[model samples]
Each structure stands twice: as structure tokens, then as C-alpha cells.
Target: MRTLGNILWFLLGGVFMGLLWWFFGVLAFISIIGIPWGRSCFVLGKFSFFPFGKEAISRDQLTGHEDVGTGALGMIGNIIWFIFAGIWLALGHLMSAVACFVTIIGIPFALQHLKLAMISLAPVGQTVVNKEDLTRKY
Candidate 1:
């Protein structure tokens, strides 16, 4: 099931998503100050390429970061991101939506990518985990 979904996703518009992520991730990493944000984009790109079998998890649960979105530093960073990478990522997903809509089989995967793209834009402290990873120790 996942294999089919992944193949369809790639055929429809996942390639665009991967390219966008890789492009921005490189741009972010090229600047030393954007390293952390670049890492987040790279992580998101991986999921964008193959997302059927995974889910996004809270980074706090995985990394034990307390007060991430609420702290002052987090807010400032999120605000800046919202204006910058956040919006671009959202747009990427929107483009995927158009690609998916062009055909019947592409619809479901397109919707999935659209949803995932929303999450990617401002991923912040979010983490992607396999759905069955609940059995694994964090």
C-alpha cells in the first residue's frame, strides 16, 4: 500500500516538493546562521519524498525540548520563519495540490502532500516518525 502511494506521489508532484526542499535547504545551509533552519528543511524534504508510512511527531516528545513554541526565542524565530520559509513551503504544497488535481489517481496523494507541506513550512520542532514506531523507544 505504501509503495503504491509513494510511487503515485512521486509521479504526481513529490518530485517538485523534493526539489523545493533541497533547494531551500542548500540556500539555508550556505549561510552559517541558517544552519539549524536548513537542517529542519532537509529533514522535511526526506518526508516529502516518501511520506505514506510515516507521521509527524512532536519534537518535544522525541528530543525533550521543553517550552519550545512558548519561549521568547522560539516565538521570534517562528515569526521570522512564518514570513520566510514557512510561506514558501506552504506554496510548494499548494503547487502539489494543482499537480495532483490534474488526474484522478493523483488526487489522494496530492492531498496528502498538501497536508504534509503545511506541516513542513513551519516544522519548527516537529519530527517525522513511522506510524508503527510507537513500539520503538524514543
Candidate 2:
């Protein structure tokens, strides 16, 4: 099921999204300031490529920050992201939705993409995890 969804997602437009993130990441790395946002885009691009069986989480765990993922900075960054990549990705989803709607089988997947695209806009400090991972006893 996950594989099928991912394949459809890739077919629809994940490739472009990944590449866009990578491209921006590369450019961001070129400068000292753009590096953070660029890296975030690049990392989040992976999740965008195959979002199934995953969750978007805060980066606090990774950084050991007391309130990394849900803080003032996160809020500000998210707002800025919504203004930038968020709107663009939402458009991408809208476009994809229209294309997918042309066929009956694509409706569900198109809706999924639309949802993910909206999430993509403010993906700051979030990570994706497999849904089944919860079942594994840590």
C-alpha cells in the first residue's frame, strides 16, 4: 500500500519537489546564511518524496533543545515559510489535484498530495516516521 502510494506520488510530482528542494539546498549551502533553510528544505524533501507511513515531528529530539520544535523561532520560521515555500507547494498540489481529478483512480492520491503539500509549506523542524514504528517496542 505504501509502495503504491509513493509510486503514484512520485509520478504526480514528488520528483519536482525533491529536485526543487535539492536545488535550493545547494544554493543555500553556497551562502552562510541560506544554509539553514536550504538544509531544512533538502531534508524535508525526502519526506515529501515518500510521505507514507511517517510523521512530521519536532527537531528538538535531535538537537536536545528543550523547546526546539515548538518555540518562538519555530513559529516565526513557519510563518515565513508559509509565505514562501508553503504557498508555492500548495499551488503544486492544486495543479496536481486538477490533473489527478481527470481520472477516477487518482482522486484519493490527489487528495493525499493536496494534504501533504499544505503540510509541506510549514514543515519546519518536522520529521516523518513510519506509522508502524509505533508498534515496535522501544
**Candidate number achieving the greatest lDDT relative to the actual structure:** 1
* TM-score attained by model 1: 0.83
lDDT per residue as tens, model 1, 1-138: 999888877766687787788787788889888787788888888888888888877677766665564367656766777787788888878877887788887788777867776786567767788877844764
Q: List the residue pairs that clash in candidate 1.
A: none
RMSD of 1: 2.6
TM per prediction = 0.83, 0.75
In model 2, the runs with Cα more than 4 Å from the true position are 58-69, 135-138
How many angstroms is residue 133 displaced in model 2 relative to the true structure, after the best TM-score fit? 1.2
**Tens-digit per-residue lDDT, 23-73, candidate 2:** 656765787666777778777778777766666555665456745456787
